[model samples]
Target: MTRKQRVLFLCRDNATLSILAEALLRELDGLHFDAFSAGLEPADRVHAAALGELRHGFSSLDLLNPKSWLEFTSEWAPEMDFVVTLCDESARVDVRAFHGTPKLRHWTLTPSAHGATHAIENAFWQILKRVEDFIAAERRPWPSSLKLPAVASCTTDACDLLLSGQ
Candidate 1:
């Protein structure tokens, strides 16, 4: 089976844009991708407004604690397939040194400079729109007669027994 794609969303802090991107992608089922978010330097907590915006469309369960990019390259490293940077500052640096050779993309958003409520919400929605477009593109169907393995399927003995004509 082909491996499921692993995507990491990054920003200066794992607080706003990265957090929302992770949550939004989770709500999109057909994309068949796993999402994670981290930062160069993390904050104490996710920004309250960002969390609230995410809650409107997704469950708050498994919400990420703020963490550094350093953690992803250590012994605890996750095998990443894509790495996306969501802000100008984080996008400008070289993340490959830490996240390995995952395909990298940048989606730059204006920073929440003054922390104005409406501005933050606007930025969130803008990012959300971009993410939606990305998911749609990724979900496009393969050509007919192509025999790709289902990477998302279970391989456990119980699953095998269930699928058998027993």
Candidate 2:
């Protein structure tokens, strides 16, 4: 069997978008990836709204915590195949600490989008959808199947998760 790819999702705070991206990617397809998240400057505490949104949907996600990008500089951090920035602030900053060799992608997930309790939930759902979409696009599209296989796209749990926030 082929080894799974390691993907890191980064944001300024690690309190919201990056956390959602990492968890959602694993939830969508654990067999294909090892997801990680970190922030340029981690908050002492994770944003409550972020955890609330996730807990209400996924039954298990112990990795949902704030972490500093600094930690990834050490030898312990997993080698990343892809590094994605989920916020504009993080996307603009240099991330040479990972030896500057990994592939990178950017998605705009502004803090402004999660301004309230309901919006916070919506933001999580949005990030989840975006990450799933990113994975689908990255895979070699089957020639006969110009569209990604529905089974491999959004799953029922994802639908429930997104709808739960509504």
Candidate 3:
């Protein structure tokens, strides 16, 4: 079977944009992508409004949680095909664990940290829209005839290089 491409969304907080991006891709393009999210310095908890907005479409938001990027540097972390930074604060990230030089894309956004309720909700929806467009644009029909080996057995760098189309 063809393997799904893996994507890691990152930010400074991991509580809003990254979480929402991960959840949105998993819910909408689960067949094409394996999505994950993390932050450089994680917050104590995910933003309530982001969770509430996501719950409107997804059956469950159980997977959404604040996480640290350091977790992905471990050998046990999943090999990623793409690394995306969603907030300006985390636009420049070090991605050493991913196989090869995975595609790195950054989308900068401004968060009204202390702004009104509407601003926070707007950020959630805006981020969701950007993530949706990104995944949708990259989504493609897997070559039905192409046979790939089990992803678990591949070396981290090899897996990333293979996905990089090299």
Candidate 4:
């Protein structure tokens, strides 16, 4: 079986955009990828409006409490295949090289500093749709050369199930 791709989503607070992306990707399942999220400076809790928006596309279990990027560099953290930054601030930072030598992608989004709750939710939905599209287009045969872990086997099945549902 082909290995699952591990993806990490990063944002300034790990409260809104990153959390939303992580949940959406998780809902897509184990066929193509597994996802996690973190922040440069995490918030105490995720934004309520963002959580409400995610409920429409994913399960609550997929939404994580805020965490730091430092955790992923630790021995206990999962080795990621891709590390994505979903906020402008994180995109500007240069700390793209993490422990597992993951490829980095930037999906910059405007922060919802002044928008209405509904508007913010809509923005998240749009970003998630884009992310889904990227994942679909990028699916490929797993390479034998990449030194991956055992858990990566879920990538194909989860990604397939996720795309099929959409």
Sort by TM-score, best first: 3, 1, 2, 4
The TM-score measured for candidate 2 stands at 0.74
The digit string of per-residue lDDT tens for model 1 on 19-41 reads 87887776774257788888888
Residue 91 of candidate 1: its Cα lDDT? 85
- Top-scoring candidate (TM-score): 3
Cα lDDT of model 1 overall? 0.74
Q: Which stretches of candidate 4 lie over 4 Å from their true place?
A: 60-63, 95-97, 110-116, 141-166
Candidate 1, residue 5: the lDDT equals 72
lDDT (10s digit) by residue, model 4, range 1-166: 6678888889888887788788878776546788889999999998888888766646555447899988887778887888888777777655544666788888755555324776666667667786778678766666577673455455787868666874
Candidate 3 local lDDT, 1-166, one digit each (tens): 6789888999888887788888888988898998999999999998887787776769548888899988887778777888998766677676665656678888766656324556667777677778788877888788778666767677889979989999
> Which residue runs of candidate 2 sit more than 4 Å off their true CA positions?
57-59, 110-112, 139-166
Each prediction's TM-score versus the true structure: 0.75, 0.74, 0.77, 0.73
The candidate, 1 or 4, that scores higher on lDDT is 4
| Candidates' C-alpha lDDT | 0.74, 0.77, 0.80, 0.76
Comparison by TM-score, 1 against 4, better one? 1
Model 1: weakest 10-residue lDDT segment is: 140-149
> In model 3, how large is the Cα lDDT of residue 95?
64
Query: Which residue segments of model 3 deviate by more than 4 Å?
Result: 110-116, 145-166
